[model samples]
Target: MSLGGESWRWLLASSSIPAIAVVLLRIGVPESPRWLLSQGRVDQARAVVERLRGNVEAFEDLVRNHVSARRVRYRELFGKKYWRNTAFGTIFYNAQVVPYFAIYTFLPLVLLKMGVGEEDTTSDGLLNLFLLAGSLGGLWLVAKMSRRGLTIWSFVFLIATMAPMAIWPDAPTALLFPLFLVFTFTMSAAVNLDQVYPPELFPTDLRSSGVGLLNGLSRVGSAIGTFLLPLALDGIGFSPTMLILTLVLVGGLVVSLLWAPETKNSTMD
Candidate 1:
């Protein structure tokens, strides 16, 4: 933990240890029954499914119909029928990350700009914990809420929260924290929708492709936003940066309004 010159390496390695634990935990887990069935190992699939569900015979038709044996083709993602889904997923993902990542990656600096002392170390950790709690709360709410409604409202709230910072750049230092929490909480909910909606938008063959494309686009957006934010902060100043990010959220709202399909209560084909 106290590697002197290698302290930076320790910081980089912090998450790897937990990842190793996950790999170890997953090693003993059985292969998915649906996967086995798709592979033509009907007996093994039946055994696994029956062991888990106690009624494989009853669910056999459903599994056979639902799980496909065909490999996922990258080309299919760009095909006419699937292209909209691809674009929607990519844009939906980009919509959230561009602003959210900018805010997240620069929050400490933003706080400092708001007159919070540089030595205030506890705020970041506390804020992250609160954000994580909000994410979990959003996870719980997902089952009850429609994806389109949830996503639209989340973007609306994102715009609402950022509006204050954009309008009153020199706002009272006390107001920053609460406004930031609201923004983070709403953004987290939208992120949850980002994770949920993309896969559902595609069918079995294209689902992974859709989700992967969304995540890749999201990472790119995050990288670009993160890289640009400091320059924006220094060049145009904080209020303009806030307005830009608010516009990014507005883009998400527009996309959700125009393109996001309601998958709620509808069967995934």
Candidate 2:
């Protein structure tokens, strides 16, 4: 558990060991009924559905006309029917990535620059504790509120919180520190939308592909943000860099307004 220096590398690698356990756990699990149905295994799908659910009749009716043995094509992602969903998911995922990755990557450095000590465990612990609380609160909101509303409002809060620090990078630590907490709170709360919506937005036929596309493309954005953040911070200073980030959030807000659909308590199309 030692996490210093190269020990962190071992800690990261050790995390993957659980995946092996998971693979073993999946050895006897039934294939997804929908996937079985898609493969034209109607009897197997029905049996799996009956085993998993008490009623197969309702599930059958729901998927009866929709289920097909036709092969899925990658081009469906770009086809007229799904191209908009694809764009929305990718933008939604990647927009959050740029800010989240950059900010968290340099959070410690930002704190140090603001006069907090490098080894200030108390400050870091408190931030993480509040982040967990925010995540739970977000889960509550995700179930009760419109996904689009939560996302738009969270981006607004993020832009508002970033404004002060961007406008006055040298503000007193007391005034600026709470801004960090608020930013973290909103960012954590808003993360549910980023994580949930992509899967919900796509139909079962394309769900995995859509989510994979979202994740894969967003990671590229994260990598770019992580790489460019330091350069931007050093070259442009905190205020202008933050101003640019604010604009990025604005773009997210606009996308959510124009394209994001509400999926809470709603049936998938």
Q: What is the TM-score of each candidate against the true structure?
A: 0.87, 0.87
lDDT of each residue in 30-96, candidate 1, tens digit only = 7656556666777887887767775766557766575557776798888988787777777778888
What is the C-alpha lDDT profile of model 2 across 47-80, one tens digit per residue? 8888877477776785667646556788899999
Instruction: Say which candidate scores most in lDDT.
Output: 2
Clashing pairs in 1: none
